[model samples]
Target: MKRLLQVLVIIFPLAVICQPNTEVYLFDLNTTGNQINITNGKNISNNEGYDNQPSFQYENTILFASTRNGQTDVVSYATNNGSKKWLTDTKQGSEYSPTSIPTTKDFSAIRLDTTGLQHLYRYRSGKSKVLLKDLKVGYHVWNSRNMLVSFVLGEPHNLIVSDLKSNLNIQVDTTIGRSLHNIPNTNLVSYIKKNKNEWEIRSLNTRSLETKKIANTVPNIEDMCWLADGSILMGKGKALYHFNPKKDTEWKIIKLFDKENFDNITRITVNKQNNKLVLVAEPETTLKPKLENIRWIAGNWKGEAFGGITEENWSEPSGGSMMATFKLIVDGKVNFYEIETISEVNNSLLLRLKHFNNELKGWETKDETVDFPLIKITKNKAIFEGMTFESIDKNNMIVYVAINQKNGATAIVPFSYTKK
Candidate 1:
């Protein structure tokens, strides 16, 4: 079975409601004598929800699927001025894989309707009409003004070529991946053939239906784009690789973005000029929240805060929660105390704390507590919305909290603690 076929089987049931949180990034690409330089990276789709499947409409404009107004719609973004326009706003369903129809101002996309029907449609002047009916098209690329090649969903998920003028659809291959493109400076369209052991990049001549193997894909990666120089670019992890079928034997590292927030790179594309590259990726901190990630925070700590001696004792995680108690001592006497807990809530972590005076009188109401939602959890850090906990080592730690002062100003106070 193909890799995309396996993914479709799992996601098809909740395809409409369970889209992942992904963002689209744009970069300026320059290739000079086998040295590829990627710079000026920008997050074009800064929205909080699913944004992916980017394709260049022109030299300065890009089209992609974006989640907005409770549905996925087509969004056109201008690379020159950093502007955007919503091209489709349909209440019936969501759209994906927006691409410009050859030699026309209109565009085509696969719209998954709420009734579980999927088809290809063309948009002209803000109106849409069905172009290929009764075919479950997932991804497509135009071969000419009236011809296109698409990945159609089925038991095996097939590669299909549709001729609009003749009202005919031809099945070219089966068990294919989602990345499809027109081979640069050729009359052929490219598709992936998933072999049992290794996947191969293959090309199809739309006119004669002849097929030929171009090259093996980059390990398990299938998403790629062709540059004007006939080289291919693919991403894995935080690195982007380059391959030239005419000269290279294997994929070579062109650039690595280890310090950036890009992760799980997929769905890449380049403009006609080949100077701009667009890709889809999840942010580095998008991992699911788990108590095991921050288990290092469990210990006894002593430090200083608010011109006083401070001490905190944290219990190990148990019963889906970690409890802690903090005390402040000034002038050799107890000043105040706080009760805090890190609890599992809705599959994420939540930090709640309450304040009390020296005599154990509550400073806030019984139900009132300062809450901080989990933002992200890294190897040695647990970052909440307004507070952060960092472990310097096994016996040392630091906690930063946002403090509202008496003069209506807020400040970040850091407490450095050493284990007793």
Candidate 2:
């Protein structure tokens, strides 16, 4: 147990603090004839905190891990009326990857306790018992009443087949991903076989222990589900793609939820009847204010602004601030100078600047300074109230400032710079 905990904490952290805020969405799926149509999409897990790993518990019920009281637990949602029921509430541990057990009313999930003991357990009416005590099962699926295939956490996670009837465990494959499901209308189970250059969806024959590649996955996407007609569905960003191994040459986009702002799509599953679909995604959020997010701006930069050559030297972030000095030169003479600082204030960022003439005459009063509070931050842009800093690459950048004109209007002026 201790060794298993060490592996889990190193490879995949189960703690609540490490999880991101996400939601689970349900959609009505229609795969009639050659085309597919998805409609009536709704967010089933709409609460705050982490909610993911969705699976169909029954024809009209969906099971997933949801956050409540600062910890994750299994929750079931009804597709008919949008109702929910908590299945497990443990104070010292959390449950994830809940799935229905074949030929039984009970379900199973992987539980991670406070002491770092991770194992798969079966949940009955109100009690639970460990299903696989020795292996730290990250995700699993039931092949039949007596057979199970699990993705066990390890140095390179292994895919194991456990027979409950004979108490036998066999390692079938290694270096696999978490998405696993029984292929419909076949005696095979599907799993992701990860490789160095690409990942492929492969099938494992439970009887012969044979494996074969089905198709290469959508680049870096591991989560997927099988339709009733043996077609596969996978989500990436805001788009859902479909692949038919028999006829399709490559994965093709079937639906795009661009207007929904449902980004980072993962962990998708379809119901047994192929009429319902559930997916997990992280919604777009405002970036938090942190100097670490914009530390790439610290360097010597030269650019052109105001019809002259401008230069700025910035200090690395320290003492809750980053300081810089800017100078503008034109016609072989120093035009003006500016002193600037971006400081941490009240849990946010505040940018302040003071302007001076070439001869050191103050343009503003002794206490007056231009201020621009931080608005948001993206992967390459740091936006303030009236100013923005955009990094094009390691050696190039652009700064856009709102400048007041003589006509009592304001215009955005761009300053392009190259790192020195």
Candidate 3:
């Protein structure tokens, strides 16, 4: 790739949505109106170990943490070529709840270091830097670049707003849940407070730091995501629920994930496209999707990203898998190349890819290709377990690849191209 074509952008912070410790799945929304019709469900994280806490980096992109390699770091999936890549590869400790910080091209998550201390970190260009310290943040959401509302782990587990610029902490309430979210196109952030046997949904004004109760969730739900029109979607034992504070006043059962299809679910998130639902479920019960569903990725595609022209060729899905190769040419020479494969793990589609150099020497050992889980698949767009891809039309496509380098720097690589 052409090193001179690099452009940098900053993004977000980590959002520790909920800690249920389960497998994550992707659900497609078939019908969207007053209600949601989600069908063709599939598991994203098919690993035997812990895979949870998914967050959207964009409408077509997703970022999450997985313990597939015995330690927790961030990984992303691209729906376009069915490719997966590692965002954060650290030996320190595990990272969680990767959330966008707003008004930037960077993102952050909670890092529990070897000493058992939790800090909020900002990641860019394949590296990570701590944004806040000394405060054990179990969960967090940023209303802006400076103001953040977090479910902090403390003597009583308080909800506090910390001003990054002034370094002041203001407590909002106590005994709150881990689901912290930003209501779209608004300055308000929402959180759940345990109210007796039920949980109440409350809104916080980022500017004033004032709080108000807006609605309540179904009997027992700790994970939820917002729809385009400000409706709330939550998941309980076997079904999905929704509550519209603007139209209805009560929590109602709306969608269900059958025991045969999914189980032991945790954390819920919607991709930026706002058409698919993400669920964290028990790995044992998660289902696999069909290969024909992603046949759109079987072809030769070319794009410009990471300062060079990137060309990738993929085979049609067959024999339970597909194969592909990647090359980034700078000037007139190849800078880096890659080998990729897409297949099924447990019961879900899994994308694994390994990077290489100009001499065809593999960058990663023969045993590993970064793994990305399948998030959702659409006609023109598909989100793998991590990043996102958008087809403006059949002839053009856009891709975003989030990279967290081993050196502790981070970058979100952008690609643009026309079908050749």
C-alpha lDDT values of all predictions: 0.85, 0.87, 0.71
Q: Which pairs clash in model 2?
A: none
Model 2, poorest ten-residue lDDT window? 8-17
- Which predicted model would earn the best lDDT? 2
Per-residue accuracy of model 2 over 1-420 as CA lDDT, tens digit each: 667556556745544545888999898888887768889888889889999998887899989999989779999998888889999999978999998999898999988887777889999997999988889888999999779999998879999999998889999999999899999999799999999899999999987889999999998989999999898999876567789998999776666563464667989999999999889998765456888888999999999977899999989999999999999999879999999999989989999999999998989999999999987766766778778787879999878777766866455566889999
Clashes of each: 0, 0, 35
Prediction RMSDs, each to the true structure: 15.2, 12.1, 22.3
Tens digits of per-residue lDDT for model 1, 1-420: 366445544435325456778899999988766556789999999998999999998899999999988889999999999999999999988899999998899999988776566778999999999998878888999999999999888778799998999999999899998899999999999999988899899999999999999999987999999998898998865557788999989775555554457666888999988789899998766446887778888888999988899999999999999999999999999999999999999989999999999998999898999899997776656778767786778988878676776865445566889989
TM-scores for all candidates: the values are: 0.67, 0.68, 0.61
Off by over 4 Å in 1: 1-14, 286-420
TM-score of model 1 (CA atoms): 0.67
Q: Residue 33 error for model 1, in Å?
A: 3.0
lDDT of 1: 0.85
